[model samples]
Target: MDDQSPPRKGCCSLRCGLALLLHFCNVSMMSQRACLSLTMVAMVNATDAQGLPNASTQEPPGDLRNPVYNWSPKIQGLILSSITYGMLVAQVPVGYLSGIYPIKNMVGSGLLLSSLLSLLLPLAAGAGASLVLACRVAQGLSQGTVLVAQHTVWTRWAPPAERGRLTSMSLSGLMLGPSVALFATGHICQALGWPVVFYIFGACGCALSLSWFVLFYDDPKDHPCISLGEKELITASLPEQVGSGGKSVPIKAVLTSLPVWAISLSCFAYSWTNHIMFLYLPTFISYRLRVDVRENGLLSALPHLCSWLLSILAGHAADGLLARKRLSLIAIRKLFTTLGLLLPALLVMGLLYLGSGFRGTLSLLTLTSATLGFCTAGMMINPLDIAPRYYGFLKGLTILIGMTGGLTSSTLAGIILNQDPVSSWFKIFFLMAAINVTSLVFYLIFAKAEIQDWATEKQHTRL
Candidate 1:
């Protein structure tokens, strides 16, 4: 009879545990789906802005004479890549402002401004490179502001156990934009002039802004649709918010933190690798593979589309590992961070040394591109790990540092190609590989997601 009682109790415990997990899984799936839907919309918006068609309806731009993408590849790359420069300059201010103002308000304002600016882009293009750059700068700054706020809001709403999936779901925008843009832009450029793309994007941006304002709230407490029990769970699960009176973190402390530096360095590496792929891959396909414009666009998108799928898988894996509590934080971070960089570097290097034909180069490039999805694990969650209270500010700092990779890479690629187009690409690939590897070293040595004792003590002092 005593043995029977013990078995009954154990059965009850197992049932309760399963019930709790199922509930968490349901909530997490709902949250992730919302984020994923948002990402899909954002990607469509970004793609249209980059002069892409709405979907698969149009053809890629071609010269009346040649009937292929007519814009100078280099100049087109410049047009696409210029946004990062504005984004970098805007991040710090955006971060600081978000801490003082409500995150929802910041996003609302950014979307409004971006919608207006995006409308002006088609008109601005005929004004020359300066005007185009000006519009891009405005768009980039607005996007940066919105993104800082978005990060802050996600941290507040997402549960601890579900953050990885939520973060990756949101970040799917990053990959989705490039994939959709490459495919659609080629068609849009073919069907209408590239300018028409901006008109479509601007109109869509306006619509999205309306939805965002209507649907989004800064905190779960403020969300009318949110359940009281879920709200309680979120608030209780979070570590206490840091700093004084909800004030911005001191710029100096953030600048000096070793962990921050590591995160920033890793971000730079990731950005360098990513932008190289985004900005150059199409041209590489056109020039090296001798593929037609439409085929090139479709092929280029394949790697990023693959990456988008893999990132979601990686996010779930991260959460499952956490739930099991089998790996130390350091081990977990190192596993993802190292593989993310090292594998891509190796693949890129192999392409440089051994790639001979179109098939070989494409295969190597795809593999390199796919490995980047692995970095989503560390990149998505590190902010919460190190300073959950200040995720927005940290993301701002990281973006400021990381986006330099675009400015430098574009400038350097231009310089190198000026001297010799073919040989220069090889050198650039090697350099990218080296940067990726060096960043891994920094991450392994110093990057940590755990809140520091000093930050915790500061929180107490504020209280």
Candidate 2:
């Protein structure tokens, strides 16, 4: 029987019609999912002050201004950090949820909730600390949800050869979100009050949530818009991916991995130095260095900007190393991890010793910011290495442990400074610098990208 030979006319017509219908359905689903994903990305990227036009504007004359100094400076910095504190609490739960649930739905829900919270910020800001903190917490909850879930989505969509570049791009959004927020917030706040910042974020969030519902699909097999070849390439390249296998990742096994612990510790160390510089730098500049709010915002943003640029470069380098097989993953990770931790440690100490009047402080600060990119090659990619199957849960563990650094640094800054802000910065930097170097040594000793034989054996059996 010649299968390709012309069938009876009526039967042939029916078969062609069925094929056309299926193709149409697939294309429609894919198109919708792509739009949804892009919208969610925009919502996640745009919610910060960087996206607002009014973030840096002068306050109303009657609004609370510190009698001895400008109060706007304190309000802006503290409020901006408030949401992050909430995020610290939400990170682990969100990560766990990503592993157990449909990541797309989790992300969509977060964007929707966060957008709603963004709309409420201006009202809450006017109300008082209690309301403001509540709104900030809401935003944090949403942010944490989006952050973890999006990574899970990428593990499905992206390929192994492209994972480094894609991971860099995805993680870079954190940098990019703030950069855009600051730029937009500066202009908007100049023209309008701070309330406009909330309004813009809210609107974007709403739009993104709707788009995600319409556009996003959970896997390559589910994506309607992708071609057969593209889908094959993506799934083929995906390792023991989270959703595809329909089996739970053994959490206990992952926790026992020495490499996982090393990655977590290294991440914590890095976040300690980085978060302090981020949360308190504005206060430090305003109080200790005598910089105005406008100038301080721009300067405070430079480090993240540099980190974003360098992360892009680092991604390309990682890909190059893998493509050429020029070095073991250990060598690549070791070089970047060493530089990442060591350079920042030295620069941090330099910042402390140099003091407020030093001529090179700004230059050193910029260098400190740039050095953070070095860690991207190591800590950022570690999840894919140890458990490509459980990227969401594993990466979540890194983030959860790493996030504690923020709390520790904040508490340290508070206790050491006696809440004075200006007097304690140097002490804080010195301690964190020591911590970074110590962690770097341990990381160099223990961290490895290659999965052990047991992991390989388990994956082989799964096949």
Which candidate should be chosen as best, given TM-score against the real structure? 1
Model 1 residue runs over 4 Å out of place are 1-78, 241-245, 457-463
lDDT values of the candidates?
0.64, 0.61
What is the Cα-based TM-score of model 2? Answer: 0.78
**For every candidate, C-alpha RMSD to the true structure in Å:** 8.8, 10.1
Show the lowest summed lDDT stretch of 10 residues, model 1.
Answer: 29-38
TM-score of each prediction: 0.81, 0.78
Provide the lDDT at 145 for model 1. 78
RMSD of 1: 8.8
Query: What lDDT does model 2 reach?
Result: 0.61
- Report the number of the highest-lDDT candidate: 1
Q: For residues 399-456, could you state the per-residue lDDT of candidate 1 as single tens digits?
A: 7788897568867776676568659888888999999999889888988767865455
